[model samples]
Target: MQHRPTIRFHGAAGTVTGSCFAIETAGGLILVDCGMFQGSKTEKELNYRPFPFDPESVVAVVLTHAHIDHAGLLPKLARFGYRGPIYATGGTMDLCSVMLPDSAHIQEYEVEQLNRRNRRRSRVQVEPIYDATDAALVLTQFRPVRLRQWQEIAQDVRVRFWNAGHLLGSASIEMEIGQGRDLLRLLFSGDIGSGFKLLQHDPEAPAGFDYVVCESTYGGTDRLDTTDIGRRRILAQEVSTASRHRDGALIIPSFAVERTQELLADLIFLMETGDIPSCPIIIDSPLAIRATDIFEKHRDDLENGDLLVRAIRSKNVRFTQTVEQSKAVDFVRGFHIVIAASGMCEAGRIRHRLKNWLWREEGTVLLVGFQAAGTLGRILQDGAATVRIQGDEISVRANIRSIDVYSGHADGAELSSWLAGRLPVRYAVFLVHGEEEAMEAMARRAAALVGDEHVYRPRLDSAFRLDADGPVDISQAGPPPRIDPQQAGHRDWNNDYQTLLLDLQAELRNAADDKARGVVIRKIRRALEE
Candidate 1:
């Protein structure tokens, strides 16, 4: 008799970020996509704790894609004593070269800021979770796998990669569980894309599987904005509207990966076809510029029939690096487009760009990506009149708009199509990488498609066995899960911290005198210490 596979949901079971799944079988512990948590403080703090399983116990890591939320924590895994070959596509490995270092740099800078604040009040200093050194060290162990080809990474375990159409080198993993009479197949849809991608190909139509684990990022609602052409028109219209105002900036909050490149290609095609005026376009993200170069390195993998190539050749576009150059844009007075990263308006130079243009009625602050709840992008998208930035409330008089057609994540309809096939499952489908509302909604739909008894939404740290009894949660299993909002310690700490920050900022701003301001600042410091 052969050993059967047992799976544990370590992350991304209850939240939209931090995707890590462990499979113990064939005398090997295999991991998939060790990502860091983002969003509110409670979620972010989870990244500081040790991985639920011992890092050294894992034999190999199969990365799904290079998105920070999908692959961000690899360096941390390396730092904590995981020394194994990580597998991904060539494009993903190339991206990790720039992305990992940048992630580490951000961690170092943020930790420095935290320590500076700590030193002010004599609180114990905290260290960064990981550093650039660890990130760089992790890059030395990359093993590339070709698409649609099954490669054995462990004893009796084989995996194949399929283009997910979400990003460059994005893959939906297909795994063969065992051999002979005990064989089973499973599929992991790694961020399936809605059709009409600018660079990558359409998502692979899924095949037969004994069990499936899929991401339900946009499962709560069926999306109306669905095509690439329709989305391009919206962008052109926004730019054209901005152009009519003579000297205004159309600030686009975009991610640095495929999203930034895709927008440029569309804008270039639009400008060439005279659908929009030829305005000066500025890409202010160094990471995006570098990623664009990498995309060019793998132009054969791009879709759109050479459209992206022409976009890269356009003369109206310019790439800016350095803080001084980005600041100088503030003094420019003309109809132009500025695309910046930190797409959710959480970090990066987009905030600076927003501060410059958000007050102008002529400009447009276009959101072309998913703005998670509680993020500044979501606030703007919801039509907030003013938003606080850097402790000062800034007026948002500019036009704010969004078009979801550019989303990399497949919506509910697309997911249904991808999941609907001739495949008959022996066990169930596990949903991950979505908000609770989204997962529950998708679970209902999935149950309707693949029997209600066969759809499982496992909690974080939940375990299931793929034994002779088929895939089922045995009463005897892994640790009981401690998941989001339900986890005891610091449950409301995120909300409380946010409210405290806002209150302190208001008090400091309204303070009548320097003595009053100092007192308020001291109170803020004390509250933080407490």
Candidate 2:
């Protein structure tokens, strides 16, 4: 019997986060990006469950970038007994050194809080997926690989990194497996960046592959084409409008890596050139502050490197590295700007800031990145009258503003163009990392480019057999899917429950009288009883 190679869609299939994939060959199994799930509580619960695959069997782990969704679960992989070499670019390795540890700290801290409440309620305690110590240990296994150079990771398996332009160290992984007549050429596009990104160059990759696993993050939406000056102008207007309220603060929920750095450079430039009024710009998250330092170290490699260096050195910018210092921002008077982490407002200091200022009409929440479905950021972006944050229902009175100019992911048109660039995908193009609608939209575009038969939309935990000709869907031949495909990217029961509670509160308040309110309550009680 001949050895057959297979590719498994372990994560980032029907959803946008938790990007893990397995490539199994005769030599061994190689895993790409063991990441953590974010967003709805149901989706997040998947993080605590055991990995569907055996970590110990993985011979190598290839990382694309250090974003929490793509690389967050690495420590958990380490905890599960995988000690293989993790390959990434030098920049990715450096960023992960700080990011992975921070993710671990967050898990430990959040778990501790949950356990404290559980103890009080006489409920069973839970452990974090991985701790800081595990995060630290995983760092030792990192093996940095330079871009555009092919390196052998396993027997008869070689990979080359291409600049993805998504983050500081992001890259697309191209692999050459087997030898001679049995050779397989595959490409995994790890979060391609929008060509219009302010701080990075356009995404780059080679063409001609047997199989291409691509991201469909911004598949259905197309942003207006804007030049660098135009992007800055939009930001300036937003800042200028918000700053007019001298008594309020502007809260920017930003991703700590590239997004924060890009905003800082643009904000400082606007201030120095008088495009916008100068104000105190506070970096509230310690992770953002530390990541900023790393960005500074590699400023020379970034576009507009001088602007970034200037922004970091600017006196108007302040970095709060301690808890006390972060808390002190609350007392600061006047119109100031704060950039905090956990960009989707899922966790981190941004939530605290939002809780404090969300109810103030004068305050403004400027969202500059992608907000995944079921996250607090998405809920606010969708315009909720009230949002629950850490058990407190806070009224949404702040000016909620969002701009697409700063998004890291390329929009639908760009993604289509990217797929076209990698033309003649002989076997198949597996679309992942997008919601159902976005994926469907991209599937149409992909079909036009590579024939409808060559486009595949894989579900979570689905697997495909790869051979000399093409891919065969062997999903049914394997174990059952880890999750229901229908629930992959949609808001789960937790979101529904929260929405119901809020709706009930509004109904009671708007009732004609106590009698009407009692009728509403009784109706709900009757439904519950049934």
Candidate 3:
């Protein structure tokens, strides 16, 4: 029987958010990510849906990074009865300790508001997808693994975590699947961070993989350099201009990970050089606070910018571990800067600040990361003259500005160069995350490097089974054993391991058989010929 792995994309296919993938083999099942679904009403609705497969049966979850899109749904999985080990980097583990719980709180709050709205509209009652207790349960499953070291996930699967350079504990996973005699190396690009980023080291490409699942968030477009330090100058000028207008606060909607810290560093530098006045800078999000602490903890990872950060740390200039102080910044109202999380302004303390300052003509909201569709951040980024926040539509009087200079994900060239460096690839599966256009563009560029014949941009619920022949499908096959037409069919999953195994076995058998494989060839021919 063919011993190749059966991979399924449960989420993060068409639009970025809710990143989850499953790999099934004879030995057991391994999931790459268990992230939450974000963006749009329809997409958000998917979070309430039950797991597509048996969460309890999943052997282990290897998380690439701590980004909510890649690691947020573990609590839901845990609450649903998954007790397997959840593997992630030390930094990711720590970040999740803060992020997962915060996510649960946000969910609870959002759901409560949604239900209130539903009641007014005379709609059915709704429940939160998962709670803080569920999130706390998943924390027990996490087993932190350091970077660049190989650790066995099961009898046949060995995994090594490498710093993806996206966030503090962000990593790209290199997993070797199948038993010793029938090994297949698969690499999962969680989210490739850029090269030459501040504070964090550059992304290091893993060598030699039989199959690759890569993220194409910015793959279609080239990285736009403002040319000759223009971005830095723009940022400095913007801050200076705003400071001159009034001593009001400059609230920046930034991801708590790399973006917040990078902005802090830049702001600090501008202050030190007298480019921008010495205004009190606050890293306001608790998640960003914890992430900054992790950045301080892992100072060794700072390849070139070690001394600058160290100097700042020594001077006690960084605003970390001061939540009360962060809140207090709002009252003082001088030429101060506050960088907060929930970058999209969908949720977080940033919302409170935006609610207060956005109507003011002089205040500015500096967007420092990608904003998902439907997020408050995106609306503001698109120059929405007015937007609703917590039932009140506020005018976009604040100076809305975005500087794409500090994104954690790699730009087009960096992604292309990373892919090109990893030569002799058998097949490449492009996972279009962050944005749809980004994924399509990356696929085109990857096709250029490795030939279009070997590239695939898979959509949600698509499956790719890899073998010596190439990728095959087990997805569209009739009635997967775990899935049932009837609602409340938990029995179909709870004790149906045998059925899953048998179906997988049959698929493998059919793939191995020359006659059956020949049918697939003819089917491909008919489609191509048509």
Candidate 4:
């Protein structure tokens, strides 16, 4: 008898970052969304570790989207000698063309900064996970696949794409594996988008399948909205009011891709219709500006597409691609709006912009998307009075407000509604890509629809055996770095660096007032001198 088809949860089993899963069968090996681990500094170290499996052995790959957490590791995977073809939509490939290189630049830049500090402390220097050249190598492997078209990727496995409505070229992958007697259907919902998107359609519901893998981001509850159309009306009012009264800048920390373009559209529409006065709008993110070019190239592909195309071309909008240009904006800026990236506030020009604008009462920090836990964005959203940046504590006096209307992920209701159409799911339903609470809550809600026995939330690196009947847990070694950190669904890290990191993280988390701490240190030094 043939061995049972097995699936391994390599990444994204517990956390929202590092989305990777592998499936093995008699035909061969297949992988989906080899993404990088993200979030706190401790969590990101997982990206430096070797892949759980041999990259060269994988026959083919299907990328779900171009977001860093979903497709960021492709460059790293390729760097390790994986020469296989990567399957993605044209838009995904195009976005990755810019995004992967940008991620590589960050990796290189961060490593340089880290080493400079480490050198001062006489600590060992570390290498970046991947560089821009490595990212370029991965780009050569992407093969574009059109939406809704079925293409066989392996001996007995065929795959098709359906728009996920999360990001450009995002999709829900439907797969069929095996011959007449052993045929099995599986679906991977990469990231599901909700209604009220500015330019994209609603997420496509899953079709009938034996097994389904779904994302549970925003699983249990909903992000409260601040405006009707992605908070554009509110944004207009805030910008117009600030432009007229305060004469200070308005800063929007946005995701460089869809969020930036959507805001441009809404702002243009509002200003053109006399809803608000048109102040100079400066796009300070280099990545966002390149992505805008890609958006214009694909204008026909979006809803109200040409309108934004025209809006971006207008004289009031400025794309700052060089540091000189970005810096130049500050000199002439009076009541202008600066949109920057790293939506979660982990990195990017947004940090610099935030540092300069956050202290001014006249300026406002308008958060336009989800801010992950433990990130600077979340700290600001939680009303932090002060935050340390680049070794300096910065005051946070600028008004911080978030509007959830720009989110790309579906909420609890939308997830349930998406599943409502796929009633009577024939086999196991696995939930990944969410926090522990979210996954568990979604499990509870899904149990009411599907039998409790059929719903499974696999932990990171957990193994499962699948056949015609259903899926069952299998005993196997967990994925590499299977447990670590304070976040839910933690995998382990065995390196000494991790041990040292844990200690440092504890100190940071438990640190006291800076001035008082310095005084205490001086007192100890004086006592030692005596």
Candidate 5:
């Protein structure tokens, strides 16, 4: 008897980062994505753990995009000895060439800092997951493929790419396994873009599949559909209000790939058209600077590509590619707009900018994308009065604002519409890459289109068998999950410890006298004893 194909969920099952899936066939094994985890400490720690499966066993890797959460772990994969062909669109490959190396640099730099502290405290040292050499080596394995074309990746396995519209080269992968009578059709909706995106065309894909795996990033929420003009109007209002302060700075924490480029275009347009004051616009991220050049290189493929080209070349816009230049922004006087990277404020130059300006009443932090739970951006959005960054506690006196018009992921309604477009799913629809609530919410909406019995929300490390008829739940046969489902998207103990420290400081500060402070400390000591 022939062995039926099986798929295992390694990451992005219960949370919104580290998107990886393994498919096993008679030919061997292939992976859809090998992404890195972000967000909470628990989630990010999963990146340090070994991949659930052997890297050498993977025959090919079909990358959906270049986002760190979707493609960040490629260098680590290469470090672990997987050197097979990693397939992606030409645009995705271009973005990854720069992005992967940047990610490695961050790893090395952060680890270096961590080791310094560790050595001072007599703690064990930790090594980076991968280095610059590993990142550069992985690029040699990437093989670019065009959209809407079928390519045989492994024996009896053929794959095709569809425009996902989320980023420059983001794609929805379509696959066919086996041949003739025993063939199976599957589709992976790799981060569907909001249809109202300003940069790329609307997402497109073929319909009628045996099974489908979809993303639920914004599963339970819906937003007003903002057109390009409407989006620009909203941005203009924000810029106008923030720029009114002569000494204030407008700081935008953005993703380097798509969000940064889109913001630059709108900012430049608003400045040139006199809708907003012409303040100095500084691109303070080296990754974003390199990404913009890639965007310029692929301008002909984007909607209003000419506008982005013009915006990048605008005389008022400045690109700061070195650390010295980024630090020089601190000395610039008057009102200016600075855009930095790591949209979640988890890493990158955004942290430094936040540290410098978060205490100033005139400064403004404008968040333009989704802030996952436990991220600094979410903490700010949730109205935290103070925050700790790089071991320094800073008061959050600056105005914290957000605008959803620039989000790349589709909202709930748009995601459902995208799912509805792909009808006649014969087997099951697996929902991944979202929080628990989001997955549950999306499951309900998806059940209405397909039957309730046809939707499945697999936990991390869960595996399923795809037979000729439908899906079989074989998750128990697989290894246990690396992280508990309860802890996936939520804040970890580190966050709790930080909160405790802040609360203790506040309590001690508010004490009326030394006696009262001693009483507070005794209560804490008694609780610890208990």
Candidate 6:
């Protein structure tokens, strides 16, 4: 008779995306956050791999939000024969209806583009992991639950959601799994949002958890209004300056959801306050336009959004819904601010805008998000004097400015403050959605402040078994996982060498077919060597 459930960290341990966790109890098995990998190429490659746990063996999936990193790979679970319900907040479900299909379309288009490039280079064909049909299949499995309602997700595992205020419908989940006699409580902060934002309520403290897995995206930095104040000051200063100097575009690479709308709200406020001379602020992303419309519909959830709008009382916040209207923003030219999506300037209309504006002295490129390690935004943010757009390398004369105050994630101090108010805990486990250095720093802070002797930074596929009377059992038993060696900087052998080694292994197995099964050992050894 097992008394406590075992928790496993499958994803989002070492990197920012691909958040998944499994809780195994005497009653059954439960999983959380079946998300696909994003960011760098090696990270994306994880999407093609098998789940660490048996997909069919998992009982249900509890989603915290609909961000691509949190809930994107859910359809793949269904494809792999898991018949289970996916529970999330109503807002999260609604957002997924739009985002999932969009994700499918983008994936299909990306695969097609990849094939085209591969064909031109004479390479092998590959397939998109899943399509719109798979996404559609996933939609049927979603079971919407309201915030603070604890449903029995599995036989003994009960889960509840609290608003994280990061995005529309985003939540921090509190899960209790056990017989009614006793239980182990686990809290997962799903991309914890900035406590204060328009159109969404503030993130609340997740109460009563034996173990807490918090996000640490801003764990290393202090919460500063620098992003908001600085961006506003620069936009006001530069746009006013640029308006006087020449007539060119101001391109802002933004995230489609919260970031775009936040920019609009701030800029609108700035305009009404007479901080900058009023020029047309064009929100050029179609998805952003639709999301803003959705934001309007879900006004009840927004934190003082209606009152804020009424307080400012400005009517020129533009939402460009059509491509024609978006293209029209580019032609207008002088003293204009254009916010576009796929924030890293990797793809979307922002790229086109950058191609045109980067070489010009009067144009300005404002970066307003955390640029991932390999993203084009990071390159520019790091002060690359010149950057490549499409196929041409263009001079980066446009002033590059980053204001992090608009960042939705909680910063280091905010994270500490959020935890500071919580009742003193016996132990805490930090996990979900952040980079490695950030996690390590947060772990240290949490350990020192909480005075918990068992603060842990879990490795991928590692399991934690809670003890009835004492410390946890930390052991090496876990699913056999293979992370890419190249990712950690050990790669002299490329694809060709890997193929040759595999072929030789196959040939050796066939010739010694009687006892060739033993060569499986050698094959794995050779593959690891490469």
Candidate 5 runs further than 4 Å off: none
171, model 6: CA deviation in Å? 1.2
**Candidate 4 — which pairs collide?**
482-491, 482-492, 483-490, 483-491, 483-492, 484-491
Model 6: per-residue Cα lDDT over 389-489, one tens digit each? 65466778887877676777878877777666554554665654667678777877787776656577665566778665433645466545447422421
Among these predicted structures, which one has the highest lDDT?
A: 5
lDDT, candidate 2, 1-530, per-residue tens: 16778999989989999999999988799998988888788789999999999999999999999998999999999999999999999889989999999998888898999899999999999999999999999999999999999999998899999999999989999999888888899999999998888778899999999999999988998888557888999999999999999999999999989899999999999999999988999999888888888888888778888889899999999999998998999988999999998899999999999999999998999998888889999999999999999888899999999998898998899999999999879989999999988999999989999999999999999999997778888999999987887788889999999999998998999999999999999999999999
Question: In model 6, which regions exceed 4 Å deviation?
Answer: 1-4, 226-245, 307-329, 388-392, 469-475, 484-530
What's the C-alpha lDDT at position 432 in model 4?
89
Q: How accurate is candidate 5 locally (lDDT)?
A: 0.93
Query: By how many angstroms RMSD does model 3 differ from the true structure?
Result: 14.7
Per-model clash counts, in order, read 1, 0, 2, 6, 0, 6
Q: Could you tell me how far off, in angstroms, the CA of residue 385 lies in candidate 3 after the best superposition?
A: 1.7
TM-scores across all candidates? 0.90, 0.98, 0.84, 0.90, 0.99, 0.84
Alpha carbon lDDT of each predicted model = 0.82, 0.92, 0.75, 0.81, 0.93, 0.73
**What digit string (tens of lDDT, one per residue) describes model 1 on residues 1-530?**
36778888777776777788999888599988998776656677778887888899898899999988889999999999999999999989999899888888878987897788789989999988899999999999779999989888888888999988899889999888778888888888888987777777788845778889989888886876567767777777777877788877789999988898889999988988999988888998888888988988889878863777777778988888787988887887778899998788877789889988898898888898877655678778877766776556777899998877788888887787788852576678999887778888899878878998888887667788877655778524555554553441122465445555666666777889999999877876898799
RMSD of each predicted structure: 3.9, 1.2, 14.7, 4.5, 1.0, 10.0
lDDT for model 2, on a 0 to 1 scale? 0.92
Q: CA shift at 6, candidate 1, in angstroms?
A: 1.8
Clashing residue pairs, candidate 1?
A: 247-334
lDDT of 5 at 90: 98
Q: Report the Cα lDDT for residue 206, model 2.
A: 94
Better of 4 and 5 by lDDT: 5
Candidate 5 vs candidate 6: the lDDT winner is 5
